[model samples]
Target: MNRKRSRGKNPWRCSHRYPLRRRRRATPGRSRGDPAVDPEDPEQDPDDGNAPPSDDDEDDDEAGPVVTTTHRRFDYPPPVPRMPRETLEMLHYDQFWITYVGTRYRHPALPDDWDMTVEISIPDEFGSRQNIHVRHAPTRRNSHEAAISDAAREALTTLCHAHREDMAITSRRYYPCRSVERLDAWIANPEAEQNPRLESTIEYLATLNTDYNAALDELDMVRYENRKLRAWVAHGVEPAEEEPVEDPADAPRRKKARYNDPEARTYIRHHED
Candidate 1:
């Protein structure tokens, strides 16, 4: 017997006649979790800056940059005060003393190539006087003058080292030596035979150096005031009134002398027969 079909509604619907919607597949380079895009979408462009990020880009954003922090400490030394150019130039050369003992002995057969020794006095880089001893094995062309010249040259080279600025010589004094014997004797007994002229020069240079450093400190104070004034103007505030400077005489005084009388000869020279 043939079964009769229901006329009100079909019990089983054909899948081809009413198909359910299926999810779209991702393209080859598309990442998971990214919204599926329609190839036919007019806004979608593979080469556009707005293109979806790949798997690597997403992973990088999830993992933030790896930073390395280091802590270090450094210690710096205080700055050295620079000497003015004029000062260096004026102090570059100094007086030297050379004594040929053989000349006083009336030795006519003294060889020109005899050993030579000289005393060199010049201002050091710090503007302090320094006395140096120089000895040279004389050649056939070397004389007393040549020996003195060589010593002076070496002393001058030391004074002008690392100098590239300008400074003026406020004052300089040159004293003539009357007698070497007297000088040597004075060296032996400074209390009895003091060189007043040289002592005065040393005192003057010490005073000058002290004055220069004090002037620098004053300049720093002035600059600090200027900076404060500028900051006050920027902030639209009235600056505080400065106190009157005290008289220099009223300031506390301390005798800070850097001068120590240097010996004429640091060590005695011994001659061998």
Candidate 2:
């Protein structure tokens, strides 16, 4: 026998009416928690400066920089060395002593040649420096002597300007040299001795130092005497105070002068004082 279908309402009424289609995802085939994008909304580039930074970008900024250095030990090359140093000249002018030292060194840029550098050392014993390394100047040519002279002039000029700016000469009873021409003339002359004023000042300083040392020695002797006196007093060894002279009337009478009368009589002589 053949079964007939129900006619009131079919149980599979809309099952096969339309073909099934897979809905396309915003990030094609990705069904993550990110909301569907609106096609009508303007596109935003994350690299744009006006756009707000993402949480991941902020976290990356907060993290410290990653170090990519190697841990292996490496033997580095030694530093370039300076050749033998020679004293170019020494002179005194305006209470200042200038010492120029010539130095030879191989520059990395000119490896085949040795270059000369002049160092100007001014002994400003009374100033802010003991032995001041004033300037280190390199020569354009191969003339060390001329270079030294030029360095000296330039160094003096610089020092003069510095003094003008801040009075950098902090030594007592001192001043900067303002005249380089006169100094050069003096240097050129063979018979030119040290500055007379500088000599006199130095002589006076030496005398003062000697006097100071003598005074200190005297003070030390005085202190030693004071300490010795204190120790003697503490030990009850100090000298006794001198007693005052007694009056003749209060003193006991002697027995010899009265008995000296011609017959050698034994009589006591009374003191009338």
Candidate 3:
């Protein structure tokens, strides 16, 4: 049935307006039945307006205490090392005796110009063992004479060292307490000029110095000859020979002719003819 339209409004407009008003429920985020936020409520989050309240503490309790399985470590000491079986043992002796066992030259034919091997026997080893040392030119290539000098010098050095204490005692005996205020200062006094001990030491040292000087001179000659020979050998040069000595009897003698001689007279007559 057709109803009478309102006087001021259109019929279509009135009908659409009433239905829209009744169909529009609450606005999207807010509804009439939704719970209101209490300002004092502890469980509610002031910042989280959209999310619901949660029971975080109850959930953590339900998960219980965390259990972790760890790996066990085993520690043992390092293996002990064993000593080598092939190691040699050192020979130990309380005392050792040394004895001269003669010298051996490097070259038998040219012994004077060669090195010498001095062998010393170890008496503790029952003379079966010997220590051989090469005695040669100390500074440069010299002669066997220098080698002998070196051996003598070494022997004297050893002898002096061995008898050092004895020599000191002997010196003290010569310069007694009455000699000076102190034994060391005895040589500083003028009276010590006549000291027998000082004289003997001076004489001994002078003799050694003289011998050493002689050896040095000999060694110098040997060194010069050796160097010359080596240089000549390097250049492939033969050594020069000594000149032969002239004999007075081998010279041709001329006899002086006298005017009275027959040969001279015949020569003069031949020339005249």
lDDT of each: 0.28, 0.28, 0.27
Ordered from best to worst TM-score, the candidate numbers read 3, 2, 1
- Per-prediction TM-score to the true structure, in the order listed: 0.20, 0.20, 0.28
| lDDT value, candidate 1, whole model | 0.28
lDDT of 2 by residue, 61-129 (tens): 111111111110011121111110111121222332233333221111121111122233233546432
For candidate 2, the TM-score is: 0.20
> Which candidate ranks first by TM-score, i.e. highest?
3
Clashing pairs in 3: none
Residue 56 alpha-carbon offset, candidate 2, angstroms: 74
lDDT of 3 at 46: 40
In candidate 1, stretches whose alpha carbon ends up further than 4 angstroms from where it belongs are 1-194, 236-273
Question: lDDT of model 2 at residue 237?
Answer: 44
Candidate 1 to truth, TM: 0.20
Instruction: Give RMSD to native, each candidate.
Output: 39.1, 45.4, 55.9
Runs off by more than 4 Å, candidate 3: 1-111, 125-150, 166-204, 207-225, 228-273
lDDT of 3 by residue, 1-273 (tens): 975444543322211111111212334774432223323478975443322112221121111111111110011011100000000001122222222111221211122233222222123356333332111122222343344344333332222233334433332222111111111101112234677786666555444444443454456556556644643544434323323424321111112233333321111001100
